[model samples]
Target: MTRGDSTELAAALRQWRERLTPADVGLPAGPRRRTPGLRREEVARLAGVSVDYVVRLEQDRGPHPSSSVLGALARALRLSAAETGHLFDLAGVAVPGPGRVNDVVRPSVLRLLDRMQDLPAMLVDARTDLLAWNALADALLGDISAVPRERRNLLRMRFGPGGDEHHGPVDEHGDRGRLDRSSVAGARAALARYPDDAALRGLVDELLRSSESFAALWAERPVEDRRVDRKAYDVAGIGRITLDCDALEVPDDDQTLIVYSAAPGSPDAEKLDLLRVVGLQKV
Candidate 1:
């Protein structure tokens, strides 16, 4: 980043800090007649930065901080996940993360998804990148488990044409565009939180290069994720498939638990049964 950009960021941070109130930070107003806003010491203590550093930062006299330090400060300030991520972005040190996913699923969460046996359940990252799913998910969908590790990502499937991994052709004029756009929006949001992440960059770049549709939507920089949404899949062998997919953030409220439900006693549900009976799907 340029020097001007750095100073601008520092100035912005100062303004943001001053505007916040005690309630904004879950703190007391204490005594009045203080600095314009949160005290340097208060912010420093909360952010684990030295008061000197805070002053230097506010004054634009300090060097740009590393992403780790920025994240620590973000945590200390009790920033909302999206807000925290944006803070890092302004600081030009965005943390490269695709929602924390080190097998962090809670047992209860897993049990909950699994219990909805009739409905295919799966957990996807903030990027709508499928993380984990029940056996029924693999069966009802096009054996995503059969997918190689690198190609397992949902974005790659829809947009990574150069990839050998194949699913039946989805008609863009139909509902595929809706599902594709929704998922891409989720992925773009995640990329914003991790702009410097090389792996994510590669995936996004690949998708952009492979599909003109992906290219156009990516440019819009949408924020349409973080809630319940559904998609219909045209799975092979099973013929036309429709899934009422919903995104549910688990206990951590970070990772997404995307569950795909078929209507009660619907054909989709019937096809799902074949997976269990035919041994075509498992974990």
Candidate 2:
């Protein structure tokens, strides 16, 4: 970046930092704080960077940050997708294009998740990386929060070794083969759309290396995207319940919101109500 560009970037960073409060990002608002927003140390900790680097960047003395560093800072600052692209531009890094998967969840989508309190819902990226889920989803599926961020992928959990060890409801439909094929097909379709995405390519490579079944299905060159399906889960202490799984598309971001619900007044619906109570108790 040019000197003038660096100056503007520095000023923008400072302004962004100062506009946010500790509560905005789940940090405690400590007493007797002189700063109007998050402290430099807090930002460094959140972004996994050194305090000195944040200082130098704010002062317009730091070198242009790499794309990964800029991404981390964007997430740390809770920047909107547009703001993230602007930050990349300021750093002279190419913003993720149509060839890449957009993993950033929009704020409005998150609110939609919040509003869907009666059913199990989750948001996943184009590659089926688990992004966010409501409490009902957490209770129905295994406690996904316990999984490491890098390992919290739907296909990885289904196909990776020891991935099924999580204690919770198990798929009782006896349709693993079909599910596996469809998942692989979806991944293949995502790969076709985002041929330049390193993470998607890496995931496909890892699965091919690790799973014989995945490799066999992938060899068939299946390329279908996920839509609506039926899933049956055997919840512990609640018996078996079957639910309709619907995939809602967010085409702009290449994301899907999956919602699990049962027919009204059906036995499964009653089971879901019980599960909601169970979920609240755990929380």
Candidate 3:
């Protein structure tokens, strides 16, 4: 299986290529962005790697990757699906496929979410799919129960404009410009793994068809999740709110557990309480 290193690198190349974006995710495309996708140099900078190393890997140069390098690549490129698996495979780690929910939250982790009533908390599967969420957090996003099961994805919502008009809880702020820019970065990062994924491909097509900004960024394919990134939102009647979005790594699963909270009992906290009242009143 060690010889499969070339295959891994080859997969990574395709994944990386599909996930890159220039100027969208802070990668300067210069005058050569006509083709869309990564420019090789951006991958190097984001992954903390040498340009030559990226070239070698992209070309299937038979280089075995170290764990640290793989982790760095995963973070830098916002790799999803096959891309993450390929990274692990290059490093001789086993990878799971789509819809593979091997993650089971420990009691201690669940307890942590329950105790932090001041915030919105939920667990997302490895593919960045929301698996479970507290009621307060659920209100932040639409009725989690009401959202279509398949469309419960963050990157897809933003990148795949046809998928959903709004980002889950992420767009509570009214800064459409900021949301547009950041969503492109996130989509580029998240799609690095499954370049050929039908679902992902569909979303990309939708984005390209809808927003001009999305079309430009989609072409660049920048990758990197930077999961803990912060965003502001202006939900209808909710006023302005800020939430700290972070990914908590869990064992045995690629799912990310998330928590959202306002600054120490801020007005946003009361707003969340209001959300509960309004959300339940309709039921």
| TM-score of every candidate relative to the true structure | 0.54, 0.73, 0.51
Cα lDDT tens digits, model 3, 27-123, are: 3356856555876766665555677888888777746766545654664565555556656766675543454333233445544555555566787
Candidate 2 achieves a global lDDT of: 0.79
Q: Listing every candidate in turn, what is its Cα RMSD in Å to the true structure after a full C-alpha superposition?
A: 15.6, 5.1, 18.0
- Residues 83-183 of candidate 2: C-alpha lDDT, one tens digit per residue: 87788878888877678888666767766876788999988898788766777887787566556556768888878887655432334465666777788
Clashes of each: 0, 0, 27
Candidate 1 local lDDT, 87-120, one digit each (tens) = 6666776455544322233445545654665667
Q: Which ten residues in a row have the lowest lDDT in candidate 2?
A: 163-172
Collision pairs in model 2: none
Residue 210 lDDT in model 2? 98
> What overall lDDT, based on C-alpha atoms, would model 3 receive against the true structure?
0.59
lDDT of 1 at 275: 50
Worst 10 residues of 1 by lDDT: 163-172
Q: How many backbone clashes does candidate 2 have?
A: 0
